[model samples]
Target chain A: MPMTIDSSEVLKRIEDAPLLSSSASRLLQITADPEHSLGEVADIVKTDAALTARVLRVVNSAAFGLISTISSIDRAISYLGERLVVGIAIDICASQLFDKPLTGYEAQRGDLWRHDLRVAIASREIARLAPQDMAVDLAFTGGILHDIGKSILSEFLTGTAQSVLETIEKGEAQDYLEAERAMLGIDHAMVGYELARKWQLPEPLQQVIRFHHKPSEADEEHRSLVYAVHLGDIIAMMGGGGTGSDTLQYHMDSAYTDYLDISVEQLTMTLLHVEEEFSKMEASLLDGKDGGT
Target chain B: MSNLILGVGDFGASNSPGDIVKTFALGSCVAVILLDPGTRSVGMVHVALPDSSINRDKAKERPGYFADTGIPMLLKQMSSMGCNVRKLTVKLAGGAQIMDPNNTFNIGKRNILAVKKLLWQHGMGPVAEDIGANYSRTVSVSTNTGEVVLSSPGRPPWKI
Candidate 1:
């Protein structure tokens, strides 16, 4: 018999999950605010010496192909922007989670991070094309953290990939998410939502983590942003950057057209752009690669 | 033994025996494998889209990114190595719907069709294939024997 987990047990695990660092959390908070300035983002980075170094390291990394090194935090923040800086901080703080081998999904270590980075690039591209005024950076951040729940839920799902796939193939479930719920009693999205709430993340971020797979269900104000992420996630998987067996297993919400105005041609161009951007970002952000002085 | 791994929009051709051309994590993307028995030469192209008309300039720079461009490029590369097109064996893998039951983007389906249409235009077609489904695939083709194998998570490697 498959292991049956209680919602309370999952909630307890979320409560025990490590908290995001103040710098990372604050960056997430500030960057989501449209009125926030680069100076304010710089100020937050100044408070955390370690994050400052990482910011500089990434900015100077070969990904940017900078002719000269960026020595100041303010310059680094301005050059790379708050979203990437926050991404660096969050990456450092959550390295373990992002890099964990998802045995459940049969994904190798670093697979989750690579998939997220591709989604971030694709999401940011989609946001830039939104008909409404949208915060493209927030979409990038949301894309990075959208599947954080998978890391936690992966263990419980260990060795169940074949069975889950069978359930879907047998018509016992609508999709992977439904299969997850049917077998485990809850899905990764719900677990991620619980973790987001526990971490006191911004409401929009929480909504993205929870409703990215179902954008129409998200609050109206953030529906476009969620749709951007929804398409971004699919594009990432399509480009062959999926985490594991579940890659592209989620439904592509067609309602995204109601929120974003991207045409099929634009989407094809977006996929090409994502391929170009992702190569650079992956080299710079992935661990053990030389970022240069 | 040597391995030449192809990322999305990558192409490779090898005539040396014991060489393997492989690509991993093919979601909606499709890979075309070619083998010439006469020369023991093998080539593969991982195509991400159907039409090169989407971006002519990108097509010029990375011909392996679209089926219209990538197939011809792979054929040219094989010919350059003294392999005859008519005598070459071809196989296809990937182009899965993944989870898009509605085929909203329809990229995977389109990719498969586009590749087939392009091959038909070339007076050739795939001799073996394992295309379409909801899972990702990792594929490899050996230069030594032109053996094509496909593997996915939690599944055994099987030949096409």
Candidate 2:
């Protein structure tokens, strides 16, 4: 027999937890006002010495391919622009969330981190194709945070998580949502949505968290963004450096292309581009040997 | 033996006597199908990215992953096998926006645009296309008769 857990209660518990407080605060401030200069943003980042160092290290790394070295937060922000800086802030903030293992996902501590970063990179590259303003920093943020609920759910279902992992490893045919629903009575997408709302993430991001796995069910207005993340997630899974235990494959919905006015050639081109981008980012992220600095 | 099927994550080709080459499940990623009606030689390359310039080093490791690199490579391979570019009738499928309403990351749309631009630049426009729907499609091209068909979920298969 399955017990019904109140999502609201779970959400409240997540909200009360003082996790990533400083990083979340910085993101809120940056998103609240994009005009804030590098100095202002840097001030917020500098408050967390460790985060500031990581940000600086990432910018100076070969990943960005800068001709000259970027030594300080202010310089890094100025060069990368406020939007990218905010993106980096969000990335650093969410980095800690991946420290714990996801039992339901068979993901080692760093696996989720790598997967999220790949999705973020792919999503950002994809975003480059859209109009600049509509790019929505939240896309990258959402891409990075989309799987957070998997971690949460995995933590909650410690015992059953192993079974799910075993099933996936055996190449069993099952939808991840169905399996999750069967095991926990609710899917990770819904749990992620609840957590997003509890955290007061932007409305668009909340929608992204809820519908990334099933964009067709999302509200018509934001369906395209949800579809983008969905595509990104699938591409990430297909690229397959490190996917967690979710083996359910969702077919790509054609209506999404019709709605967005994209064509088959375009989707192929984008997937290729995203795959390329993911490969590069994957190498960079895992290039611990080079130290990347 | 006559019908070469391209599975998900797989590519297919046929030459000599010429055979029908078919691929299924195209979404966001574009499937490039090339056929020489005269020789009946057919080849299809399904690529998932636009350009490989962003990471030339990695592209070398996986040339089939990007359109910019993969398309040229496919063309080169076909041409080397006696498939003339002029006789090559091209059909494209896939590139659907599988994302959210806001389209914060409209890679599918961008990819389609890039393919069009590339095709125009190279003087090879797509002859037939059924692309950019919220649905997934399975595309098949018959080298024997040059028939292109697209099938969607719960819907009857249609010719393009």
Q: Chain A TM-score of model 1 versus the true structure?
A: 0.96
lDDT for residue A91 in candidate 1, whole number 0-100: 85
Leading candidate by TM-score: 1
lDDT of 1 by residue, A228-277 (tens): 99899989988888888788777788777788887668877898899998
Highest DockQ scorer = 1
Query: What are the RMSD figures for all models against the true structure?
Result: 1.8, 10.3
Stretches of candidate 1 exceeding 4 Å from the true structure: A287-292, B98-104
Clashing pairs in 1: none
Q: Model 2, B23: alpha-carbon shift in Å?
A: 23
Q: What is the TM-score of chain A, computed separately for every candidate?
A: 0.96, 0.76
Error of 1 at B25 (Å): 1.2
- In candidate 2, stretches whose alpha carbon ends up further than 4 angstroms from where it belongs are A1-18, A32-40, A64-67, A81-84, A91-94, A128-133, A157-174, A216-221, A251-253, A279-292, B1-160
lDDT of 1 at A197: 89
lDDT score, candidate 1, position A249: 78
